[model samples]
Target chain A: MSEVKDTQGQLWEVFIQTKKGLPFKHFGSVHAYDKEMAIQNARDLYTRRGEGRGMWVVPADAIVAIDSSDDESFFDPSNDKVYRHPTFYELPDGLKNM
Target chain B: MDNLNLSKFCIRLGDHCLIMAHRQSELCSNGPFLEEDIAQINLGLDLLGQAEALLIYAAKLEGGTRTADDLAFRRPERQFHNFMLTEQPNTDFAFVIVRQYIMSLYLLKTYQALSKVEDDTLSGIALKALKELTYHERHFAMWLKRLGDGTEESHERTQTAINELWMFVGELYEEDEIDFMAQKASYAPTGIEMKTFLMEHITAKFSEATLETPHSIYMTTGSKKGIHTEYLGYLLTEMQYLQRAYPDAKW
Candidate 1:
């Protein structure tokens, strides 16, 4: 019964999965008065051309993001960590599906 | 009935979708919001696709040089046989949703029955149309509920639309002479059964939306018999303008 409308509409971010077992990718957002209409809007907007097999809608306000403007405080610590990269290690020769 | 009769009936069916598409396109870039605009366009596109296939089949059945384009653009207002409900003016968003909701529900029942007809081509068309119709019915249904239960003005506007358009609902269920013949040949379903299903679904949806239903039992008919409202003339004037002004025009 998630619903949105013109009067009390809330913005919902849309995620679409093109196939089963695939990750849902963020497409965009739509304002809807109810959950049903939100999903309908997503289907019409995001999947009209059979672009996706599944969809997830969450209120825009539900998402929390790290403050990107202050990049050095958090994300920068991992930006140049070459040891964390798989390419940094040499794989044993001929390791299939590794 | 003869092939001519069957074709005539097919024209009526095609006209419903074509006219509805024509009317809804009037809302292009005029929707309440961007998402709404996109939704309306998708709905119109679906109607347009269905119209093209049905009219193509109709033109072929007529066994003449006439094409779907000819039937769509060249026919005078009197020759076009679309439901009065579909040819209605888009007075407001509420009206558009209500009128569309009614037609979509009607289509859902009729198309489902039509998909099983003895004629493979027509049945295939019905199957394709039903998939499109499924989304259409839901789109309008969702809007109808939102408008009917939203604001006082919205509720009032929607109720007025339903009251104004309810009288025409009878015509969708009426089996005309050609329709009866099509039913006998298993090319189409009986309108009465579809009407019953439509009414039940409409009633349930109305209650959920908190919308009022018109009590008027008086019915209006004539579109199927080549008679139409004054609105149709104006609509045709705009829709056929490009083709009429420039014969053999192409995109």
Candidate 2:
């Protein structure tokens, strides 16, 4: 299908931090006219269920992503680096979260 | 403090919330876009939850057999004590935002006072609802600014809405017998105090939005006696249809 024209302002991606010490995870996107509106729309859409303690909204166009054509070159090289898994290391007994 | 008067007071507040919730619900699927649609519905749900809490407390205080559902769905137009402004029709998006901005500010101040009252139940409910109303006030205030200052057409529509709704605001601060009694019992702030605070805040916000407050001298009044605009009855017909058709029907 052809790309549909959008008149609903700008697109914003929402990230939500479920707890104070945790990092914000990508939740979803919403359409808004400005930064304040983007934040409010993210709040109304994603945080209605007490889902987050903090939120961040970024313009959708600001994100940079690799194209699908580059997936093989970008990801295949990492698979052969088995020593990077840190399996040869030994940990002390009291280390809990390592 | 008279239990009868206190119960009536709770019913008045609950009716305001219930009717406002119904009005917001009317815009559920009709918002300008999907995000706005969800936002409006979320607002309605917040009001609905508040209405349930207040009405349940009112029923308990009255020692009545009627449940919150009965209070919401079974009351006739004349029995509802909501302010006339709450029942006003959503003539347009500008009207809806303007109405919400006014009512949210009114409720924010009222609830702030109630949160400090001597009554535990009412004060507790007010404390919790206060948090929600804070966001409601901010959201609408933002919209009011955008619409008021956006474009020529939007500015005109927003100004017209303010001019039309200005008259109904007087009813919010008119001290009736119930309000007088509540004030005597320290259950609420005095009408003059609330009016002063509301008008000052409204003036400041309107100035920020580049909107002028109408100085119309003919302020309408009468919601204290269960009187409302003609729009309320039709709204009730639609809201109460299922319950009226099948008495005691449950989802």
Candidate 3:
């Protein structure tokens, strides 16, 4: 079948924070015409099960992603950089979060 | 504190939620999009939850062998006390949104008043349902503005819906004997208060939406006395079909 035009308005990505002090993780996406509609749609779609205490909606097109073809060049070099690893430095016994 | 009237009052509240929930549920798979479909169903679920709570309380007030399920499934058309607006058909998305906007406005005010009533159970139920109705009112109001100002076709259709459903808006605050009894016992807001609030909010919201409020002087009434539009009978038939077919059916 030929591709049909989508008239359901713009796409939005949803983020949900399950608690007040927690970070908002990427939840899902919904189609809405504007920011207000996007937020409401996200609330209805992603938070219906009480899974979220806070929500954020961003335009799907607003996100910038790296090209998959550059994955090896961009990411593989970091894998062998042993000195950059946090475990490479031994922490003193009294050290805290470090 | 007449138990009979108070019980009847609870039934009226429960019936409104039940009928409206059923109307929302009818559009389960028929929403314009997947997100919208789920949203509408979620609205239905919220209303159904409120209905069950109100009906259960109504049954308790009656002090009978009746369960909430029995009150919901066994009641006949003439016995239901839902507002006529709640039973209107979802002709289109515009109609559904308009109907929901009107009902939500009414319910929000009603629940706000009920939350402070003398009765503890009713007040508790109203407080919880008030939170849900707040979102419901805002959601529908947003849709109303969107449809009213979005496009020419949408604007025209939404205007048509507002005009069509405007006739039933008056019945929401129509003062009847039951209403008087509830108001007397501190169980509900006065009819005048409800009417004034509804008129002011509706006028302001309509202006914001760039929609015209109908100038018609004729308003339909009579849901309080169980007199409803013909559409309700058909709706109840479908809703009660399973229970009527198998009297002992269980979930």
Candidate 4:
């Protein structure tokens, strides 16, 4: 009856909410054969009291991870380019809300 | 039974939380890693919080000078009524998972039933606790499935845990006259059967996990009456040491 073993389950990410009016932030990952199983696992892993409103379980392989080595050239130059900081320029009080 | 009798009943519920919280507390700084360690510790805190609220209610019902602390620290092992399931030593991750899985299911059912209690305080406590326990159930249930379906080693260990612990599930439903009294008093639901619900949920969970269900007829008893397995005494000793040693030492 063990058609698909536990080991064959795929990894899926989870998100959760701690209470009402909360967002379902990324919580953790669980392994399951399909989306339905993944959602169930996510419910077990993420929601307890109804702690989670919703969750999205993407296969572990589907995520394109950014390489750590590209940290310098990828974004370091932006630090010296102060123009990117919107806070650097003071806007008049008329545009304060904007 | 009168409210005095009901106090004893509430204490039994408190004892369940206190003992389990005490067991979970040992995990502080001893979790597998930072996140897991924090999670277990948080779980311990939550269980203790639940115990505190229930015991305080019990103290009020008794119409005596005793407080929650008295019940928590001064009570003997034989006086503390909790299920044997919560009292079992967390021998490994497998045991921990099994304990959480079983307790979560029980708490979910218990709190849901208790939410409609006539007592405003009891209903409030149940309402708050119900939210927390829902998460507890989900967390352990997910892990049970993962570990059951994970590596061969993990699967084997978890299956062993399930088989070993299966006998204790019976205690969750073993109600007596006291429970019936509580039901009649509107302290809890009347004829609320937990066995069928528990069995169905666990059976489905095990099936999904591909874990073999144990067939042992040796169901442990006496937890409802405050009698316990051998492990409870040692657990109570450590748990009560502070209060026992320094009587009235509290904030």
Best by DockQ: 2
- Can you write out model 4's per-residue Cα lDDT over B1-251, one digit (the tens) per residue? 68887788778877878888888888877765444565676677778999999999999888868988888889898888898888898888888988888888888887887798777898898899997888777767877887899899999999888887787787888878898887776665444467777778888898898887776778888987778889999998898898888887877
Q: Report lDDT (Cα) of residue A62, candidate 2.
A: 99
lDDT of 3 at B225: 78
Off by over 4 Å in 3: A1-3, A88-98
RMSD of 3: 2.4
Q: Scoring model 4 with DockQ, what do you get?
A: 0.10
Model 3 accuracy (lDDT, Cα): 0.90
- Looking at model 2, residue B196 earns an lDDT score of 91
C-alpha lDDT (0 to 100) for residue B164 of candidate 3: 89
Instruction: Looking only at chain A, give the TM-score of model 4 against the true structure.
Output: 0.67
Tens-digit per-residue lDDT, A1-98, candidate 4:
56765554677777666655566577888776777667765654466455655567788889887799988888788877667888767788786325
Model 3 per-residue lDDT tens digits across residues A1-96: 459988899989999989988888999899998998899889888887889888899999999889999999888888676778788677789975
Instruction: State the lDDT of candidate 2 residue by residue for B1-251, as single tens digits.
Output: 67878889999999989999999999988999999889988998998988999999998888878888899999999999899989989999999999989999888887887899888889999999999999999899999999988999999999999999999999888898888998887777898988898899899999999999888878888788878889999999999999999998978
lDDT by residue (A8-98, candidate 2, tens digit) is 9999999999999788899999999999999999999999899999999999999999999999999888767889688888998997646
TM-score of chain A of each: 0.76, 0.83, 0.80, 0.67
Winner on DockQ between 1 and 2 is: 2
lDDT of 3 by residue, B1-251 (tens): 57777888889988989999999999989999888899899999999999999889889888977999999999899999998899999999999999999889888988987999877888899999899999998899999898988899999999999888999998887887888877887777887898888889888988998999888978898888789999999999999999999996999
DockQ of 2: 0.93
Q: Which should have the higher lDDT, number 1 or number 4?
A: 1
